[model samples]
Structure formats: structure tokens, C-alpha cells
Target: MATGSRTLWKGAITFGLVHIPVGLHTAASEQGVDFDWLDKRSMDPVGYKRINKRTGKEIDKDNIVKGVEYEDGKYVVISPDEIEAVFPKTTQTISIERFIGANELPFVFLERPYYVAPINKSDRVYALLRETLASTGKIGLAKVVIATKQHLAALVPSGPALVLSLLRWGDEVKTLDALELPPAGRGNVSAAELKMARQLVEEMSGPWDPADFKDEFRIQVMKLVEKKAKAGEGQTVLQPEEDAPAHTGEVIDLTALLQRSLKGGGKPARKTPAKKAGAKEPASKPATQKKAA
Candidate 1:
């Protein structure tokens, strides 16, 4: 796939002694519908203004300062020079610290993804790194500074490209200790029901084809916008019909659900293996014939 020409960041991948110059290109783009706030009377676009929340007064750009809340109702003012001093050095390098199994990292840690490619004449080293990582099923974990912010990133080999996925630091992720969660086990699930569920899953299983899915809402919205533009006037349009509600009852019948899920019918029960052909039968007794004679 062709990546956009815009290069977001310029850097190099650095390991022990290997250094490969590279650049980061955004892998994904925002798909949100753009909207503007307009004044009701004049139909003019409304703009936002920065103001002091306490005094409700408009604040000037030069008066703004960065501060950190040290305690309740107390903030420590920090100067721009002080923040700049603490910023991570722009080394123009993605220094990989270690390699770990790609599956070891949880999905929650992953943030944004970018396509990384060799800059000048580092194609050979880049290919070597990509192949090595792909063969080993491992990804490089490194700390990189992008857009003046430090981020933990995972260097993943995705097809013919090296994908640099930004990750949240360990401390940035919140712990799940507060929420009450049940222990992992067979929770009210019977063996027969579980077997049927597995059968249903097997019956419904298919290949992962992203092309089959689409953003239907976006498509409809664009169509509506075009229709309105062509009409040249505000006109009433019929809304799409809502889908029927799904069953969400508290009492659930797992057996019925599993049965209905499998092609809208119950799956056939397991059967015993058929006996081999030409198998010898037990010999008939000869004593009864001798008594009759």
C-alpha cells in the first residue's frame, strides 16, 4: 500500500552498533465529520476565547504559564525554560532497549501506529531487521520522542513495512483493582452448553476479511449531505428505519442460545465411531445342535 508523502518524524533505529536512518509516516487518518459552531442569528462561525475560569476575564497569550497541582487548591508555576530543560533530548534516534514477544504486550498499552521506512541507503539493514523480528515473532520496545513528547513504542514488522506503534507508559495505565471482577473459571457454564457453543463458533468461523466491513453511518451521512446540496434548499428527508431490539432478558438459556446460533438450528449430537468392515463376530455355540441330534 502506498503511504502518504507527509513524513511526521525523522529518526533512526539504533541498536547495539546498527543504526538505520528512517522516517515515520502516519499509518491511519482521522475520519470524523467536520462541523462548525455557528451563531444562530448571523450564521457566522463562533470562535472560542481563552478566559480565566476564576475571574471570568479574557486572558492574554503572554500571561499564560504552565503549572502543576502539588496539593488541593495549590499549584506550582513552571517556566518554559524549566520545562525545556527537562524535555527529552531530540537525538533523532529510536534507541531500542529490548526485544519481546509481540503477544506479551496487552492491547490497552498500544496507542497510535505509524509506518516507518528507511531514509537514505539503509534498506539492507532495514530488511534484515524486519525479517529477523518477523521470523522470531518478536517486536522491539523502545522509548522515542515524537512531536516534543516522549512515548514508549513497539517496533513491529507488518508485512513489507516496519510499523512503529506508540504505547502508553506503565504508570499511565490505570489498575483494575478498584472494579469488582469475577475469577476466571466455568461460571454457570455446563459442559454440554460449552460444547454446543464451540460447535456454533466453529460453524460460524471464517477468514478475517477487512474489505467485508464498512462505515455505513458515514456513507449515509455523506449521501444525505449530497442530496441536500443538490436540492438547494432545506427539505425534510425520511430517516432510516431502526432495527428491532435484541433480546436482553436477565434470565438466559445458554442451551437455546447455542442451538439457535448454529445455523438457526440445533447442532447434531456426537455419535459413536462406526465399526470396521469385515470384523469377525463371536462364534455360535455347537452344544445345542448336538443335543438335538
Candidate 2:
């Protein structure tokens, strides 16, 4: 249950009269090769420029204004002051609205996940909350404001840690009615076919090991890069200045918390299996790889 070095947001988890101070750390990282735009001749980095779309001329930054479209070829201009006034207030609290069964949440609504770690001597209360959720098989439906935007999030107990998973708003998800999908519940399928399908699934099903998957595209691209670098064909690109690190508050002793939770009959975290050596590519390229290419 090691947390990330940097905390993106410092907040408190609140439900009823309980308050547990916590910090949100990014749980995921973007995976892929990042290609930067550069001037071919000078090898200088190229950046975006604001331009007047209709006039075909570059525009000064001061001339830009925010607006929303009301109708065709019409817009309602909004000033910076107005936008700031309407922005959601940063309450610095993950306010739990209600609790729902673990299975009740749909996978489609899940957007991003962050590790919620206890901070400022709130480990006991955090552990209590995590254990309660785990024992009851429930997840807290909460709203949290981060970077001035309010997000619908699920407070889920993940082994020794609590995960704050951001969810898309109800209206953000489109209805499936427009698609011509087959009717639900065994429509036009034979008993023998169903039996075979079940058998295949049972045979293939095993423990969920994340190491089983690998980003083949990234690996291949990195291999190509290494080959070119070894041949002295690499260019020296200037590195951009890094942003100041976010304030990481007091670190919690997760090991002790986990031990206490497990002593209360909580299950231990699952161990990830070692990745296979010399993994071979699939016989055919996967659909994802094809799309990426």
C-alpha cells in the first residue's frame, strides 16, 4: 500500500460526524511513447499558437475571450470574473452522500482512480472506514472538489487502501437505445452452444494478475529508439523545466494500519505474480495495436 511521492490534493473524508483527513495521490500513469513537435532543421521544440480562425492571422493573448455557443454562428461572451464567480468552491472535503452495494456501480461511469491515503494522524479512522466498507461489501458515493471542479467519485476499499475513483456524470454517458443491440437473456442460442461457452469460460478463468498484460507498442517503440541511439542517429532535444512538486503532507504507516485491519478478519492483499520471461507476441496483432499503429 505504498503511496505516490506527490499528493495531488489534500482533503478530509466526511460522512455523518466522522472526519478522516486524507491525501489523494494519482494511482495511474499514462503509458505510451510521447512524440514532441520540433523544428526539423533547428531541432527546436514547436508549440501551439493562437490564431483567428476566420482571419487566418495570429491573435494576441490579451484579445482572447471565453464564450459559449447559444445558436448557429452566435456566442455568449463570459468574462474571467464571471467564470471565477461560478466555479465550485474548494471545500477540501470528500463528502460521502450515501453508500451503495459494491456491484451496483457500472464500469462505464468509472473515469480515473486515485489512492486515498490517511494523513495527519487519521490512520485509525481511515482503517475503520476501510474495514467497514470491506465487511459490508459497500462503496461510498461521494463528491469531491479537486482543482476547482466537482467530481462524482466512489470511495472503494481496495485491500489495505481506499481508492477514490472519479465517475462520469449521469448525463455524460449516452444511452444505448440508439444502437441496434441483440435482445438480452439468451436470445436465439442453443443449449449445447451455451454449455460450450460456459465450459470455455470456466477453463480459461484464473486469478486476476495485472502483469499478464504488457504494452507491446511502447516496448517496440522503445526498442527502435534504442537501436537508433546505438547507431548515433539520436538528436539532442532540450528538456523543459519541471513544475514545482506538490506539497506531500505527513506520510502514514500503512503497514501498521494493514496489520490492524487484517487482525479484524480482513483479507490480506493479493500478491502479483512474476512476469513471464521472454514473452512471445500473440499469433495475430491485437485490435488495440492495429488501431494505435
Candidate 3:
């Protein structure tokens, strides 16, 4: 956890008969350019305002209402009280429904993540749960309500911390049936090519170090902004002061470069060979499926 990180949600993780109190802190941050709309003439900041679509006039905030359109130009107004009646209750508990292999989750289903830290003298139980999941190579499939919205999440043991990664709803991810991809298998690839590809992968394989990579685009943009500011090209706009902060797999072998890669030698293979003797065919069905609602 980073210094001064605030806990966004305080809750208890419940599975079976065990309960561990914990706090959820944000795990990631946006690193994109923040471009504000500005008035070019006076160097003032431009802000959004609500205007009547038909009358082309500004309306008071009190007069605005929420509505759902059922017909072309017809709307059914919904009141704040009515919306509140249907919102999911904040349970303040992450209910683990079941456990599954960590690899069972598809990458497309992953959404946002939050760091889970033990709280209220629950450290022992929290450590127990984390170590159990890590040793078993499994993750807890859980459902939690955050900010009044119910979310599907995975309780994963990441090093010394437990991470609650929110997952996309099953219906939110599109099926691959729409894609025109090649069928999975050997599919016209030769054994020699596979061997060379494996060798190339071995040559490139290294330990995962996130610090090795960075947001170059954001860095460069900030650099340009700094350069412009130093050149007196920056403008000062009036505003209210507020505190705020914010893989493909393929195999092909052709050239001598690949031969050199094979000959240059790399770290000894950590994974099973590409082709194992008497290996059984992989199961057609996925090892695990998303739990039904």
C-alpha cells in the first residue's frame, strides 16, 4: 500500500463460517492527459451548463428531473425517492460464493481492483485466508456491494496483500463467436517451427517486473507541458480551489535470427516443454465456468 492511501470501503469478508474485517483501498490510478476546455479569447476556463434542448435556454437545477424514454419523444419521469427504493442495500460485506483456480478467470472479465487490508484486529484470520488461497493456487469468487452498486469480484492473494478485483458482469463481455479467428491447435504449424518459437520465447522470458515498464505517452506529454510552461506559453485561469488527485500467442520460425536465438541460449525452461511425451489431449470444456446467477 502507498503512504497516505485512504480506505474507500470498510467491510468484512465472509466465507463459510469465517469473517474477517477489512478495508478496501484503490489499487490503480489514471495516467492520461487532462485537457480542460478553455475560452481562447479571455484565457478563461470553460465549464458545462445545462440547457433546454428544445428551448435553447438555461434551466434552474431545481427544475431538472430524471426520466426514462419509452417512446420516441415520450419520457417517464422518475423521482429521487423512487430510485432510492430500488438501489441495492450496502451490506458492507464481501460474500465469497466459492473458490476456483486463479487461471480460471478470463482476462476480459477483469475490471477495476482494490487492495484489501485487514482491520479491527482481524489480521490473523486475514493472513490465514490469504495464505490458504496462495498455497492452493485458488481465488475466491465473491460478490460485494460498493457505493450502493452490487459488483462481482475476485478475492486474490497478491504477495502479502489480498486484492479485491471487481469483475465485469457476465453479460457485459461479448462472446468470441463474433470473431473470425483461426481454430485452436497445431493448425498448419510444423513441429520444428513450434520448437524454434518455444526457444525464442525462452530467450525473451524474464521475471515479471512492473517497474521495468512505464507510461511513456503520459511522461512525454507532461514533459511538453513543462517545456511550454518554461517558455511562458502557459496561461493562468481563475477557478475555485479544490483538492483532488486522480497478449497474443503466436509461433513462426523462418530466419537465421531465430537460429541465433536458439544458439545464444537463455534461461533454462521453467515451464513444461511445448510437446511432452504421452501428454493427454486438453479438455474441450473450460476448467471452470462463471457461477450462475
lDDT of 1 by residue, 1-293 (tens): 22355667989986434466777655434332233333333323333464555455565555565555456545556666887788776544554666779899998788888777654344554676688789999887866665556667888889998887888767655555543446789898799977876786677678999988999999999999999879885677899997642321122343443344454333222121111111111122000000000
Top candidate on lDDT is 2
Better of 2 and 3 by TM-score: 2
Model 1 clash pairs? Answer: none
> Per-residue CA lDDT of candidate 3, range 166-284, in tens?
88766566544433456999999899977976786677788999999999999999999999999999999999996531111122222433354356354222221111111111122
lDDT tens digits, residues 1-293, model 2?
22234657889986434466877655434332233333333323334465555445565556666555456545556667987887776655665666779999999789888777665455665777788889999887776676656878888889998888988777666555443457999989899877976786677788999999999999999999999999999999899997643332343455664465456453322221111111111212100000000
Candidate 3 pairs with clashing backbones: none
TM-score of 2: 0.62
Better of 1 and 2 by TM-score: 2
> TM-score: which candidate is best?
2
| Model 1 regions more than 4 Å off | 1-63, 228-293
After superposition, which runs of candidate 3 have C-alpha atoms over 4 Å from their true positions? Answer: 1-50, 60-62, 70-74, 222-293
